[model samples]
Target: MTDNSVVYDDNIMITMRGVSDSVGLPYTVNPLELVDREALVELREGPAGSAGPDGDPAWPWQWRGDVADFSALRALNLTTADARAAWRVATENKIYYWTGLEFIAFDQAFGRTGKPGPANVLSGTAVTGVSGSAASARITGTSPGQNLELTLPRGVSGDVGDPGGPGRIQDAADVLIDDDHSLAQDYILAWDATRGKFVPAPSPRRGGPWAIAKNQFSGGTNLNEPKVLAAITIPGQPTRWRPQVTGQVRVNAANGNGYGTRCDVEVRIGGPTGELVGYGFGYDIQNWDWVLIGPRFDFPPTPTTDFGVVQPNQTITLYVIAKRVKGSASFTVDTTGAQLIVYAEPIR
Candidate 1:
């Protein structure tokens, strides 16, 4: 027996021998596969409406097929008969086209007919049952049978209020009289009748009279004796003032016993109860011959610190204290030509 088998070549092209494939092997050939069979059938059948069996009109292609331009549209046989048929089946204000599968209808009224219209103007004269100028119109009455008016209402004036109470006025006799002699010399206090107060009288220059106090002491003195040489009483209560003090003492060797001696002098500001507020002392005054021992000292040495704020009614005293530090012989402090002075002035 022979090997009855069919062989397919790598690049074989099988052509159909007839419309039906039912014959012996050498008389017919069958293809293994067909590429684009549907497209091939459509192309072979031609477009719809071209013709049918026995030359009758096929289904009329109502819509133009995927028209590219006016030339393609004009190519369709759009006779009166075809146009009338298309108009009956087509939608108004809409166009149709085929997208390979089905027809897609685009509504021409989508944006045009669906949009809103322009606003209307309001007419004042058209308003019913109301009356006013056409330029400024309002509703007539709020309810039935009521008429509206246009006049503005005026408000009535109120009565005058009662008179206010009288005020107090001062005269020259009503002012107090002050006869204080201590009132500074070049200054005077005058009464202001209108303001009911005492104001200082105006002067050509500033400041009042100067207040000065001084004391001097001259007498014989002994050794090792503390004596209050000069004293002054400050009048004001807790005032700032300046005090100056000077002490002069002559030392003599008794019986020609030439010996050395030291003398001390102290200046102090004391309160009413003798409490020392401020004090300064100077010592070591040597004497071999008859010598004068004295020095002037200022309390609070600098002008910046010169003002000594004293207690109420204080007394400032300058005292002399002497001692024979080295010699066994005694010495006498003679004040025959010696003097102790204390002076004070108010800072103001």
Candidate 2:
């Protein structure tokens, strides 16, 4: 046999021996040189066909005569093909495959079934039945095989859950006073240390009573001659108390032809011991107009002396006096407007 040369009539008979033995029959060689030795070698060594082990096509296959049904597949001698392999067929815009027994959708077989189908997808805004960003889908059916329907809820509220713990509350003793219990009128509420609770008690007095006395004096007097203006008597009391005295005397001397004239006023308070205790004095320049004199004295409690702290049955006497100083010009004290007042308030 030559390279790229056809096999002669004699060699054809030799090649038919293997085929005839395999089919269990006698074989006759064709008279014409139908196949060359090179072509035969290429057929054995070349790439496989579509249905061959290498899966390369022997020739381009179409939609099997452009038909889609099983009858078309049967007409193309592919219905009883190998069950392990599949064949691609096109129908309109979709691609399908023959899986020996039946034609399976290409997308479904390869799991490339595009987007969710219209049956599996939903549309429009979300209502009560469906809820999602897209309001895509919701399943509703009482029983299997029934048509799915949108079922909205009645907007009913769920049952309440169990209550929580007691928190700050401990027991009935924690409550202090309520509407059922209240304090009486004219009474004050005070905390009772012994009972550890609030109780009603009598109201306390705010302040004690006050005693007042006032007097005044008038007329003219010579130099160095002291004239008594007014005198106030303080009655005795059961309890010890303090006396606060305020006195004022207006004095004026007739315009003296000699230098300037001056007048003086003095105040004194006497206790039961017959001795003058508190003494205060004031001076005024003698003028035609009346001028004020005398100091206001406040005496608080002094335990050591009866003058500041008046004892029971003690008499308090307040006196006001006036005198002329420089010239012999007659000095006069205003009696009506001038005053000497005292207040005797009880001690604590």
Candidate 3:
């Protein structure tokens, strides 16, 4: 017995590269989800009928390891019967193809330049009854196992918020105070629930308006040289202004004051000259001595009522003026332990 089949070299090297059709494919590709896919020619080369010198009237028509291109195959002018009752068709990027009798659509995938991907079933979460500019999104589930990150829009609880006054609050502008109120330095924001806004307001009284200036007054009197503690401008006109000062005041009679040094401390209003104030006294019938004027004499001598209020809308400053009723006395205002407080009638 002789092996006679060595004459035909039918070793066709066909490589399937790129992405395979993923739709309708029992594997992964679904025929329904295909794009840029070349029409697949599922035919395998074999003897169609009687053999000729080139080889059997078969496809790929490789004779002696020499492959025939489409042109060479077309040259053969094979009839339907010659090719096993049918001829297969394929396309790279054509919308239509010629059937035996007429033109018909190729696989829809062939028309696409890029591979078609599965349609995404994107869904966004709409949280009902929540109002804010803050939004977040994440892919819950997608066909073809896709991962997508999305962001959703928010803001809008109701016409009155939880109370039904909510509106489209998309940014900081919607929550902060209105343009009508001007913010001041060291001021804080007060939440106005009614308007859904943060209104600029004064600093907390618990924190004190500010620490009083630690100033020292000496020699005869400080009537000409005064210490300005704080300056505050009224929020609006016709507002009643009240100034206050609280602190530990120390008085000392240096050398030569000789047992009869008396000092009067004056808390004045206005920068250097407005009137809304108070007073205290520091004295000793003896020479140089340290005196905490608060308990020694009537310190903060004037009652809060006597602390007077003047015109508004202007700069009202607290001025400390000290003078000696008799000899020479020196005074130190302890800023570390002192505070200045001012109040206005028309509250903002």
| Highest-TM-score candidate | 2
User: Is 1 or 2 the stronger prediction by TM-score?
Assistant: 2
lDDT string, candidate 2, 1-348, tens digits: 658664354433223211223344433443333354422211122233466466665533234333475455556665545443344444433345555676555544433557753353323233464333232345554333334344454455679989977763212353234454344444455566776766554334321232222333555544347776666677765446665555555666655532356666655666222333334443445344444432334443355545556675577676666656556666655554666556665554
RMSD of model 2 against the true structure: 27.5
Residue-pair clashes per candidate: 0, 3, 18
lDDT by residue (1-348, candidate 3, tens digit) is 999977446543334434433353434342332223333323233334676567575333212222234344355555443432222233233233223343343345334378778887654445533344456656666576655555555544457535645564323674565567667665667787888777776654422244443433222323323444334343433333444454434444454443655655566655545453556666664433333322111233332433355444455545555555675444333333333333443322
Q: Output the TM-score of candidate 3.
A: 0.30
Global lDDT scores for all candidate models: 0.41, 0.49, 0.45
Residue 251's C-alpha lDDT in candidate 2? 67
**lDDT for each residue of candidate 1 in 1-348, tens digit (9 for 90 to 100):** 886564433444444332332442343333345453311111122224756569666544464334454344345545454442222113244454433334445666234655554443333233233334233335454343334433333335568888867643222344443453123434445666776766444333322222212234333434444445444444442334454444455555443544344434344555222423223332334443323332333433444454343433454443344444544444565544544444444444
- Show model 3 residue runs off by greater than 4 Å: 1-176, 181-187, 191-198, 206-241, 247-261, 271-278, 290-314, 324-348
- The candidate 2 region of ten consecutive residues with least summed lDDT is 38-47
Assess candidate 2 and give its lDDT: 0.49
- Candidate 1 residue pairs in backbone clash: none
Per-model TM-score versus the true fold: 0.29, 0.32, 0.30
